[model samples]
Target: MKGAERIEIDRRYCKGCMLCQYVCKYEVFEVGQERSALDYLMPRAAKLENCRVCRLCESHCPDMALVVVAKKKGKGKE
Candidate 1:
């Protein structure tokens, strides 16, 4: 199965509730020192390789700031 290419969290809309970190089964997120536009600490997507593109973080984000980008499958590669 194709995996995640990356996860994008928009700091402008994020509130740093850390729901993304709590929802992630792979421990992909962590509390970072960076602050968002609203002056709240942001969660960092650290262990990107462990992500499965399940979109749990995306769905769980209260501010809808999280986006999980899945790897595109190659045509006829299988």
Candidate 2:
């Protein structure tokens, strides 16, 4: 697999559960100081390159606020 392109945490729906941090095996997420729309502290993608696109965080998120977009393969060449 090409791995992850980006990791998105929808602030509008996110409840700052930190499930993404708990589930990320690569330690991609960090404890963020920024508060969301709901006034809950959010998690930030601190080490994006370390992610393997496992989607464990996305599935574990209770609010369905996390989205991990995988990098597409074979655009033209390697």
Candidate 3:
């Protein structure tokens, strides 16, 4: 199965619309208490392991604040 390396949320531009959370099928995000520079509630990557590298959250982000980094591919058993 594909896995994600990390999920990044740019706090500076995030409007906290939470479209990423709504689009995510893996439930990788949660409502966080932390506020962004825009003074909106930011979502936290609570369940990193749940992410399947689908990039749904990234595409759904209106502010383009969410970034999903997929695990690097390795050349093995070639």
Candidate 4:
């Protein structure tokens, strides 16, 4: 099954434009009260299991803070 291991958002570089949340189809991101290093409110990965690893959020991030880590597929043992 193809899935995302996790989504890493670099808070230091995040501008909290919410482009990630806006572009996400699976509703993986949500507005968070936590502030980033830049003092901007960051988007939280609320529903990680909903992520399809489509990378729309990563591509849409103007600040390039979003990174979607895909789950590695395991080889079948004979």
Among the numbered candidates, top TM-score falls to 4
Error of 3 at 5 (Å): 1.3
Q: Write the per-residue lDDT of candidate 4 for residues 13-74, one digit (tens) a residue.
A: 99989999998988988999889999999999999989889999999999899899998877
For candidate 2, the per-residue lDDT at 14 reads 89
Better of 3 and 4 by lDDT: 4
How do all models score by TM-score?
0.88, 0.87, 0.88, 0.89
| Candidate No. with top lDDT | 4
User: What is each predicted model's overall lDDT from 0 to 1?
Assistant: 0.89, 0.89, 0.89, 0.90
Backbone clashes in model 4, listed as residue pairs: none
Which structure is stronger by TM-score: 2 or 3?
3
Model 3 / residue 77 / CA error / Å = 9.1
For model 4, the superposed segments whose C-alpha errors exceed 4 Å read 76-78
lDDT of 1 by residue, 24-71 (tens): 889988999999999999998888889888898999888899899988
True-structure RMSD, every candidate: 1.5, 1.8, 2.0, 2.3
Give the residue spans of candidate 3 off by over 4 A: 74-78
The model with the greater TM-score, 3 or 4, is 4
lDDT at 76, model 2:
83
lDDT by residue for model 3 over 7-66, one digit each (tens)? Answer: 899999899888888999989989999999999999998999999988989998888898
